[model samples]
Target: MKKIRNFCIIAHIDHGKSTLADRLLEFTKTVSQREMQAQLLDNMDLERERGITIKSHAIQMNYVYKGEEYILNLIDTPGHVDFSYEVSRSIAACEGALLLVDASQGTEAQTISNLYLAINHDLVIIPVLNKIDLPGAMPEEIKDEMVDLLGCDRGDIIPASGKEGIGIEDILNAIVERIPAPVGNPDGPLQALIFDSVFNSYRGIEVIFRVKNGSIRKGDKVKFMATGKEYIADEIGTLGLQQIPKQVVECGDVGYLISGIKVAKEVKVGDTFTHIDRPASEAIVGFSEVKPMVFAGIYPVDTSEFEELREAMEKLQLNDAALVWEPETSAALGFGFRCGFLGMLHMEIVQERLEREFDMTVITTVPSVQFRVLTTKEKLLNISAPSEMPEPNFIKYIEEPYINAQIITKSDYIGPILNLCMDKRGILKNQIYLTAERVELQFLIPLAEVVFDFFDKLKTISRGYASLDYELAGYQESDMVKLDVMLNGEAVDALSAIVHRSKSYEWGKKLCEKLRELIPRQMFEIAIQAAIGQKIIARETVKAMRKDVLAKCYGGDISRKRKLLEKQKKGKKRMRQVGSVEIPQEAFMAVLKIN
Candidate 1:
């Protein structure tokens, strides 16, 4: 155990976390040159295409120092704010973290947030300045920033360039010298924490965990503390270039276990595993269930494929444990699932994977944040969708979720950012000038406001220089109302939204106009109305494709023309009553583009 070092890499998006990870792997020769590629740990094609890390990957490496061989377990974590849960899980399984900062961009919002997470875990922090080879690189300036943020000595920060392979050996040496090895009683009771899992069609669910207190061998009877279920360890191995089968994975080692369990929900991430013969005293500490901030409905285009969609979600959930969902049905969109995601990006990724991976065409409704509702009878309820809202007479008050949002950018863009937040009904909490040119602004904004297009707008106004990081700050009572869209008098529940009273009318008006442009014309006129309770807030009409009944009787007398027009009018009124509008898929997605 003295020779085993467990650590992970932490940084902001577009930073050198994945790039540095590649250099470390290359220097250690854990992966051959022929198999090496950019962002080697990022295995998903979507990740490669977007140049972002969506999942945390773990691998084992060997290094020899001073004529002694040492085993190193490195976990590469994602840098995006939406995937912070992945970073938290990775931090839980490590003893140290390499805080990589961009020498040119300095420390951003996500960098500060991820640093706090590592500090809370009491992990050893090794600061490294990456991209020193770039023309805009400012190693000295970033080193000073790191010193201020981490409170470490000047010499403690390593200056390197991931693209140029500089300081790779220095980083490896720091890991062997600074980071402490895992400490546990190998002969004690079996205790392990499952951090992640993946599903395989042929083998079953593969659970990846780190052993802390005892040894686990092949064919051992393991028991999960959370589920209180027992299963035989069909196969156990360490994660390397492949699943390297071992006779026994000792304490303080990370490895994968296959139990032949087919069900995905049976094995929960963050659950502890122990031997049935000798169980641990309690579960692992500092691990809690993830709370999703954004909720949306995902339904298949074909209603009959509901069962298949459910199965696809289950398998996807096994890989992304942060995703939480429950079966739900909608009047506008038949049977579907109400999925809770960490953020909009996480929701988007899930929807794309469902279509690309499972080959299931799906339609997603408007995204919303969970609200707290109190009724006249003093009953408190959690409403995730507008359909779950209680009637106006039965409700006492509604409280929406808010977040503590932090934006780090240049001082010149502060005015526009403040205006954007204010327009969203946000309150400026605090502001500080980190440097002469860089400023950090904090605001308390409703989660619903940021769920739409706040991030994109901020990026645009700031010229892509601003970075945002946020956390749920709790709930606050607000003037909120439910906005519903009706097609020809019948309410479409899927298009409903719970918005602030001040903006409900404008939001409804915009949605109606957007829908008018997307909904195709039918045989009869269609009335698209946006209403709040009994009052219509906004309305638009799609005129029917008219045929000239008077064209055939142009040469007839005035009385004959009047008679043909009367007959056509009666037929049109009857058709309007029986005809139903078939809303295209684009109309459902168009609600998001409404400014």
Candidate 2:
């Protein structure tokens, strides 16, 4: 490879990675008059809706700097910490990363995390200041911070305005000059590393990989190193969206080739692909595993749509590898998926996507942390969903998951933020203040504590001025129980959580009623009670179904009566069918609402 450059653009959620990608596409003339879109790589509606890049999109562009053509494999990686695993994996596919700091907002928590990730990988780090054209633009000051934090020379910092299309060529030159060209054997037997793979009904599986040591031709037999599965490459190509056929997706280049494989997980992200005769280096990943900290049960509000719910989850999991699911049987809710997510954001995104994309309504359980407990008979169990927990009396000891969180915010917010954290059973770790008003507070909080309402609480307390990032600290042996919510003497599976002993009563008072309001008015006065064995600490009432059951169902006309009955049935079916009462999705989401 003569002049190859592989790098990913990293920034905070709204610091303009996609905007920069759009300018690059326009600068290189990659899209003609008829092919232009504002954010070309952000092809998904959700990506544009959130104003954040969700997936790591890659595009190849040719830039001529002074007369030399350098191949720029530009990777736009997701910036949210919820997708940190994806960021790490995407960074692994590159030799360098462009650190995009918001000139106005300075360095965010995610910028620090991404910078640390790139440094940990020993990849060349190039700092660039983005959004310089904004009202609060402070490129020089931000550049100084970058020089101090990232150890970059003053002149090395590139001032850019992705919105204004300023300094695009300079960034291009810096990429070619600063980032080293990828090196790998191009003549050996075909071996490619799969960064991502997607399933298509027509194409079967579109495998995205960086060819490392060999060239893969169309119809070549290749084996996935991790799974020892081999398949014939139906077609070899690179994706700038549409397929470019007959192109050799060689070393230092990112491309998507097709294989007649249907299982999505078989050729997982970070798996290595090579010819059956001789494969490339075995697959290696920077991250050991993707651990989903937040787990919930997703059930259909209309119980008859069980198949629709399953299909919705399957389609949702295709684009999100962090999402894990399997059929979960709940005595109260029948059958549903025990879905796992990286965090609350990941969970919400999945639920919203299922509703918006699949057009299916679902009732989601309050998110919970995994627990480890032992029965009196000495049988150890790992409990994910609340239904998996052992009977209350038969349990000996329980260790619930915990995460150490660090919040960085202005000094003005310390009092309120600390109060919010402490109320959630956060053990005050320590606090340190920097030169400016910025402060960092560390807390050891139960994973179940901050698992659901943490972010929203922070936003409300600080008026959206604080930034938080947390990783799983560890699981400690403690008194953990599956607090169950009983509606009219019957347990509702979606209202359970792994709560600590001390805070159960308080959380139950707030959460049980929350679940009641979430459950619509039922036929009879339903008592929503959170109980531990025979003890009930908190209670609420789901008032008798009064507003519903329209009088029109009894109209004298036979045909009109039939239509009225059908409509009433349709509306009632939207509510939960716990024993008998229907539960609407709006009611399901209301349980999780912080307000």
Candidate 3:
């Protein structure tokens, strides 16, 4: 155990974490040069295309130093704030972390957030200044920032460049010397923490875990602490380029256990696995269940594919425990599933995967945050979709979730960023100057505001230099009301949204204008109105299409033409009184894009 090190790499997005991992794999000779690829740990095609890590991956490497063999287990974690929960879980399974900071960009919002997470996990954090080979690299300034933020000695910081393969040996040596070895009782009852899981069609559910205590072997009967389900371990292995089977995975080691459980819901991320015959007395501490923050309805464009979409979601849930979904029907979009996700990026990734991998085309409703509703009779209910909301008279009040948001950016663009935040009803919490050029600002904003295009706007206002990170700060009482879109006297449930009462007029006006552009003109005029309760706050009309009813009356009497025109006008009046508008799919999608 003295020669074994279990650690992970944590960083902000696009900071070369995966590149550094690739270099480490090369130096450790884990994969041959001929078979190596870029961002080896980022196995997902979407991750590769987007240049981001979406999932946590673990790999075991063997290295020899000073004539002594050492076992190093490196777990690569996602760098985005949307996957912070995955980062925390990965940190919990390790003994140390390599804090990678870009020498050019220095510290970012997510970098600070990940550093705190590593500190909370009580892991040995070895700060590494990466990308020293870049033209804009400033190692001295980045070193100072790291020391100030981490409160560590200047001599402890290591400088390296992932692209140039510089300082690779130094990083390896530091991992061996600075990071402590994992300490656990091999003789104790079996206890392992499941950090992640994947579904295999033939092998059942394969769980990736860290052996906190005791050992697991093939054919062992294991029980999940949370679910109390027993399954025989079909195989035990370590993750290489592929699964390398082993007879036993001892304590203080990271590996995969193949349990003969075909159902994904049977296994959870934070659950503990123990030998059924000699189970541990208690489960490990700090087991946090993943919660969904944003909710939306996903409907198949072809209603016949509804069951296919449902099956696809079920299969996806087996792999992504963070995903939650249930059957839902929309008046406009028809039957579908209301799905919950960690955030907007997660929601988008899921949608993309469903389209690309499952070959299913789907229509997604506007995303919403879960709201707490208090009824007149003093009943409390949770609502995820606007359609789920009770009548206006039945509710006493509503509470919306809020987040503690932190942003890091240069000082030059503070004015526009502040204005943007204020427009979103943000309440400033605190501000700090990280350096002469950079500033860190905090705010308490509604989660609904941040989940939608807020990050994109922040980047645009700050010239793509701003980084944001946020945490849920619980729900707060606010003056929020449901804003409904009415088309030809009918309320479109899919277009309904909850907004702050103060901004209702502006939002209603903007929504009405957007719908007018999206909805096509019909034979009769279509009145597009935005309403709060029964009162219309904004309205726009799509003029009826005109037809020359008397164009074919050439050489006929003028009176004949007049009679034909009068008859056509009466027909149009009747059509206006009884005709219902048919909104196309493009209009539904267009309204969702309205900011």
Q: What is candidate 2's lDDT per residue for 383-469, written digit by digit as tens? A: 887777778889889888778887877789999988888888789899876437677788998888787778888978878767778
lDDT of 3 at 81: 84
Quote model 1's TM-score: 0.99
Residue-wise lDDT of candidate 3 within 258-331, one digit each (tens)? 86777777888888989989999999874466778899999999999998998788778766667889999998
lDDT of 1 by residue, 288-392 (tens): 679998999999999999999999999999999999999999988899999999988899999989998999999999999999999999999999999999998
By TM-score, the better pick of 1 and 2 is 1
Q: Give candidate 2 regions above 4 Å deviation.
A: 302-312, 515-523, 542-579
Residue pairs that clash (backbone atoms under 3 angstroms), model 2:
522-545, 575-582, 575-583, 575-584, 576-582, 576-583
RMSD of each: 1.0, 6.3, 1.9
* lDDT preference between candidates 1 and 3, better one: 1
The superposed Cα distance between candidate 2 and the true structure at residue 277, in angstroms, equals 2.2
Instruction: List TM-score per model, in order.
Output: 0.99, 0.90, 0.96
| Candidate with more favorable, higher TM-score: 1 or 3 | 1
